[model samples]
Target: MSDPLLDVENLRVSFATRTGIIEAVRGISFTLGRERLGIVGESGSGKSMTGRAILRLIRPPGRVEADHITMHGEDILAASEARMRQLRGGRVSMIMQDPKFSLNPVMTVGQQLIDSLRAHEKLARSECRQRAIAMLDEVAIRDPERVMGLYPHEVSGGMGQRIMIAMMLLPGPEILIADEPTSALDVSVQLQVLDIMDQLVKNRGMGLIFISHDLNLVAKFCDRIAVMYAGRIVECCKASELHKAQHPYTLGLLNAVPDLEHPRPRLEVLQRDPAWREALSVSARS
Candidate 1:
């Protein structure tokens, strides 16, 4: 009933390679309120690129053009660098796919977390450290003190993810873009991490954009699902309606997943159609 927290319209991104210009994300549109929205597709499907483009994190050699990208009532695509910096990690934060690559290897976990909080808020040293430790505890870290002093390399993958979650949540962002937040963890740990994220997002009433290749996980954790193929979204519907998806590509993806109840000799492979890609590009431009 209220205005969406985030709105993206006709978003496009492309990379200039030696061979040719490769379009990573075709013009796509979506909106998010205080609800979970899942974008699921295989690697190179432009899922991660879409998330990065929303934050305007694309670097040189890559170009991002959007008709509109707004947060609340502010125009993000038109914002100045200084304003964008203030928006990033303050009003909108992202939890990268790999904590090992994202975290500062040389710094202590507590130091990194404290720095993140201090970047957005003017707080005393003692207050920042206290808030950092409290956030770690909130993410279900058992021994916050020990974990805080330890370097990123010393902690397990699951622990690293929880720390990253704490850091992202510390700023109290209105929207969180989490790209495969639990892809590297074990099954048990994966569920635990997702549970922590789920609980925190709901508690804070923040809109979430969950990007992953796991259809089953998305169906369970998200309220709505967006199925991406090539560089565009082919189907967007409620998670429960995924089974009844009308698009051929969506159906193919669902059929490809393994069904435990009905054991099969082999999983079905996706059948690509160049025509589909061409049509999507045309539609994107229109």
Candidate 2:
């Protein structure tokens, strides 16, 4: 079989606080092919940190260490700042959790998208504007031209998120690491955004690392699911078989999801096992 588009091994992230080293992401590894791979877990499970570490976005006071992170055979961990810049948006783009925070408040949406496009490629202003509008339309934005002229604050949360998606896709990245891309949107808009991502990933054959805390949603959207807990991936399995996940944490997470059909008065609380922190394990059900 061919190699995966993104290969991560023994990835670790930690912060040097006044107290001591706080390991946010323990040694965990995974590979991404041209398919949708979901990282699902509760909050503070190192889901977003893993995604950011893959993109080399960790800031100072925070350290990211990895055995090796290879993107298309290039060692990402050793890439220069310039090379990392080229890879960041050109080869790997990320749609953050909230658009209001990611988008430039003072800049017009069109200008931001055009600037991003121009940053990666040399395109004329008129051509860039046209492409930006087209990209906005591709994300299901209504009246792309008008919306493009508006500022980030002028748009709704859902529209802003879509605009962010449009900007990210304009670079033609081979991989997209979306960290809770739809958590801020309403249910209707959430579905639309998810559909946009689903169609785009399938059509472009891009490798997707969807980072979210919603197990059921991830199971539905991704081809495979990686269950993270206490900074470690305890299980990796086909999304269809997530119900039969073996790890105690995975099982706990599954049971914690409130069921509408069965109408349970109270959902089961997730119990943490002491041994989870001592060892990192990856299941092979996928």
Candidate 3:
């Protein structure tokens, strides 16, 4: 890849609890070019935390440490809060797992979209509205003008996700961190949402960090795959080569998925090893 869009080294996220410090992410490193990089793991494997830590969204009591986190060669770990605010939704945008919690309940879809755009760029109200509608159309929302006036609750789960994608892409960010954006939708809608995101990312030449638990979905959508286990990346490989991943944890994850064509009598139960947790994380760069 010609000069990666984002780079990180030895990134770690931890929290202080009554028992002790619980590490959510431990010394994980990766690079993202203008291509899709998928992070897949079971729940509590730090897939979401890795995304949040990249954007410095982890709050107090949750400490993020790293050798470095850089975007376009600029050190993210050293950026100030104000700079980070500029980066979020401007240079970099994040789509949360659920729009129900991420979207402002009090605001209409139009209002939220306009506000998000205005936060990143100086534009007239009419222009912002026009741009917002155009973005909504781009994401394949039907009758975007009318849809804009509707509250988030009024839209279906799939439409809500498309709206979120439109809102995030409205600012023309170079990178997008999507955390399980289609988890709430039906299988059909999930594919539609993924198609929209894939098209947008390719059209914009943007680097995408796709965080999800679906191995099949990730394999189909991403250019590269990083299999995380116990808060660390156990295997990194080309998405097309994921089935051939060597790590036991990676093989376990693949085996855990049910195949309809070659139906198994019962889904294989994932057997965990204590050593996987203690093993060093594999670098996903390049």
> Higher TM-score: candidate 2 or 3?
3
Residue pairs clashing in model 1 are: none
Q: What is the TM-score of each candidate against the true structure?
A: 0.96, 0.97, 0.98
Q: What is the per-residue lDDT of model 2 for residues 94-153, given as tens digits with 9 covering 90 to 100?
A: 999999889988899988999999999998999999999899989898899999789998
lDDT of 3 by residue, 68-139 (tens): 998999999999999999999999999999998888888999999999999989999999999999999999
Alpha carbon RMSD to native, model 2: 1.3
Clash count for candidate 1 is: 0
lDDT of the structure predicted as candidate 2: 0.89
Point out the worst 10-residue segment of candidate 2 by lDDT.
Answer: 277-286
When summed lDDT is taken over every stretch of 10 residues in candidate 3, the lowest stretch is 264-273
Q: Give, for candidate 1, the lowest lDDT window spanning 10 residues.
A: 277-286
Off-target runs (Cα >4 Å) in candidate 1 are 280-286
